[model samples]
Target: MPQLTQTEMFLAVLVAIFALPYAVWRLGRTDYYAPLVVVQIVGGILLGPGVLGAALPQLHATLFTPDVIAMLNGIAMWAVMLFVFVAGLELDLKAAWRWRGETGTTAALAFTTPMALGALVAGALLLLDARGEWVGAEGQDWQFVAGVGMACAVTALPILVLFLEKLAILRQPLGQRVLRYASLDDLAIWGVLALILLDWERVGRQAAFIALFVPAVWAMRAAMVRLAERDRWYVALVWVALLGLAADWSGLHFMVGAFLAGAVLDGEWFGTERVDRFRDTVLLALMPVFFLSTGLKTQWSAGGWAVAMFALALLVASVGGKLGGVALAGRLLKWPRGEARLIGWLLQTKALILIIFANVLLDKQVITPATFTALLLCAVASTMLTIPFATPALRQLDTHRA
Candidate 1:
């Protein structure tokens, strides 16, 4: 019978985030395909408009009031920026280069085929699409088409790593090879995103950022190497904030800067084990809020069936394109069918990064709320399908090899 203050609501929100996902994860035993992250994502959507808001407007309003949403968003922003920073830091460019021929071919095929397929789907949507805000604020139809398509091409490198670790293959040769392939795609995904988000008006500022970033990165790297590992953590946060500000000011978005901040840093300097533990801490504690905030943004005003249909189409594009690309590479490179099949399925697994990419598209108005809803659905489905199908392939491959 009482309305809670913003602080109280925030606490309640946090409690619900952690409690709901953990309960569903533990009780439902969704470990194989649906991890805690997937559970959290589903919980977020259920907590958002398509379900909860559509069903109980009064309760949804009471819990997620304007002030409460703003506060939660602020927390989510920082959490995601840091989480993205960690993603960049974990990339192994050298390893990708070392296995360049195989990794390059596979990554290229995986990305390009899905991108083209997704673009075709988007183009088909464009013939009759009536949503105005679905297109970028200052962008064109081609940009939206390409943007949505690339969204399908993404593989959540961070989530892939988690899945690999869960399967007890993080250190295995196969796991390491897959990581290399995923790492290259990670770089390409961000590059294409930057192209999609290009603001002609801010071209000068962006140019300045490019000119300044190289020196700043050098200085930051040098200072980081000199500092104690314990102190580097504190410095890294400060650096993330500063770089994020620069990126935003240049119209590139703070998340982009956060990623770049970590990308330039040597993962070795941070100690792999400590970094892993820290990543886990962020995912366990802060990322749930980000996921909830993401859920709050979901909208399906364009008809649930329409969104579902497009999502289904995009899902087909993502899975089929990834598998096709990998299959073609296997043929050219002469890899076994089982290994290629397993790798292709794993590469199709999408989560955090794809969601983040879609969030950016939504933020920039490059895609409408309805399009975002479809993409989000596609991402979740793509991720959940991974373990269930890939596990069988992995087992068969192991048997074949043995």
Candidate 2:
């Protein structure tokens, strides 16, 4: 392959880096968050070997590679960590504390029902050999089931946060409830994923290490928080380095450490505005590379009946499971029937977190390329469907608030 001129390389990098953020800022002006995901996908296809080269015939292959792809993953994961940390910082711990019982119960119902359903559906698909024969090194049918289950059960934290912010519900009771419950939901799903990864006999030591490391890290963090109250940035830099090293050493991804560190920092220690400012700077600088990397890793050719079926199954499980579970809890809790149903529908949006976890499973070989593609399609579709589906429900909530 011929190498690109320096000019070409520079232009390509510039476009790849700035395109998503520009689109996001523009979309924000119009009050649409759903289009950002579509923009990323479309941008990738356009800049990829498929469209740009076909149209221009002068673009080089230097823009795409495995190493660049890996770097993108690291950046994206860091962005996710910053995003989640900002979320944790935004949590009004006092309010969440008061609603702990309700939030815990609601989140439990919301998560467990979907997970069980996703796993069962995955098992059925595997048993029937729907997505290939599951003949890869990750075992036969059950392993596939667990992998699919984990994917289906995930909720998109970033998307959820964006939606709440857009809907002006972030400071409201319902929004606060959803955020707290969703945080719990994220924690639960991560735990379940860790367990599934271990059960599948992939990275057993890593899983064990995370399980042991989290509390110990938190305890240490608490102590550090007390001492560093006088010098916030000092504490931030130290914790960031410590967590990153610990994650690398434990064989877990550095993003995991970043996230844990952010979660520990919360707003209690650093104040919400300061944390948000730092998060924005990090996200603006590093997060687009992550999304671009995801686009680069996506395989458009991984399509067939099995992939289609799995995609359909993902849609069903994500929607049916979350909606059904939350609806049940809402009724049991004596929330108005309509409000309960709205909660079910609003929780359906899946975003960057789903994609991140999918990438992890793909890297671990827990899921095949075909399965990964299917899940990606599900993530895209679920995210798009969410805004339209939840609009009426959200409008109702708004009216109630008014």
Candidate 3:
């Protein structure tokens, strides 16, 4: 038998990366519950060490050789950076501010409530485990708890956008309201991440990065405004890359920089239609590999059952806390009975953002692989619940209106 060359092997891995998810998502018709992105994510896990590697160690090792893994990681890094940057750009802060009173009340409660519940659960795990399997080697107890809590609190803005569009409410008043709330929370989530990633030794560098970033944003915005729309797209890619480099150099991580780069620029410059196409293109072309790379990180070393239970616990905290908070906000704000229920279920969508958050935590060694796996599961489950649960609420609201 002739052995394949390195390039040949890399191509094979790519085939597996793209094929499996499409097959499952299309043939199984999982899109009603799980979007293609979600299926890709689950497929990635299936291809990763815990399942495929365990089942066929030799094939896994041979297919994902060191060079191929490196190549895949490279693609995943850029793909996610692009995804995060688009997410930041899509944030309509103006709309959020316009409705600040209601949006603030809803966003604040929606975020803080789940955070607290998730933190409590994390602390409980610490008490029960005794071996500290959940916390990362470089993490403090507080960081671990805070990271987990934030994971629960996050609403994946990009995923929420997808869901809204799917439900045919993307342009409606209710969809706009939900987007405003998610936008504010999206900003808060990144701020909390910066805090979690703070290193005392690198505090000065981080401060300098923030200081420099203001002028950088000013320059980027000025340049973007003057350029032709065609030119702006190319320039934006350069901007994302530079900020990613700067952010990583400052010990804050490239995704942080990528997001900051997009956050400062007005999405209007790109045109909504173009932005939508660009985001969809990135997802279709690049993010499958990112999902695959994410799957490769899954570990069940602490025992599969333990991880499964932890995921379930986190899921309850995420779902229940989100609904509870929104329900309270509805009562306080005098929202119609079912309005908050609809919003709560809509905001419960969490996939891309939560996975990215957990990935950062794992990268920073603030959480163990087992903990990351649990959070990943919680994210997938939460996102899957969004469409199923929200559809009913939407119909009920429509009925009431009728």
Q: What overall lDDT, based on C-alpha atoms, would model 1 receive against the true structure?
A: 0.89
Tens-digit lDDT string for candidate 2 (282-381): 5567656666665555454444566677788888998889888898888778886467766776677776667777766766576766666677778777
**Which regions of candidate 3 are displaced past 4 Å?**
129-131
**Clashing residue pairs found in predicted model 3:** none
Give the Cα error of residue 308 in candidate 2, in Å: 3.8
Best by TM-score: 3
- Residues 271-336 of candidate 1 have per-residue lDDT tens digits of 999889888999998899999999999998888898899899999999999999989988989997
Which residue pairs of candidate 2 clash?
Answer: none
- The per-residue C-alpha lDDT of model 3 at residue 36 equals 96
- Candidate 3 on 1-402: residue-level lDDT in tens? 899988999999888888888998899999989999999889889999999999999999999889989999999999999999999999999999989999999999999999999999999999886436889988989899889999999999988999999999999999999999999999999999999999888889889998999898888888888999999999999999999999988888899999988899999999999999989999999999998899999999989999999999999999999999999999999997699999999999899999999999999999999998999899999999999999999999999988
Weakest ten-residue segment in model 2 by summed lDDT: 131-140
Whole-model lDDT, model 3? 0.93
Q: Each candidate: how many clashes?
A: 1, 0, 0
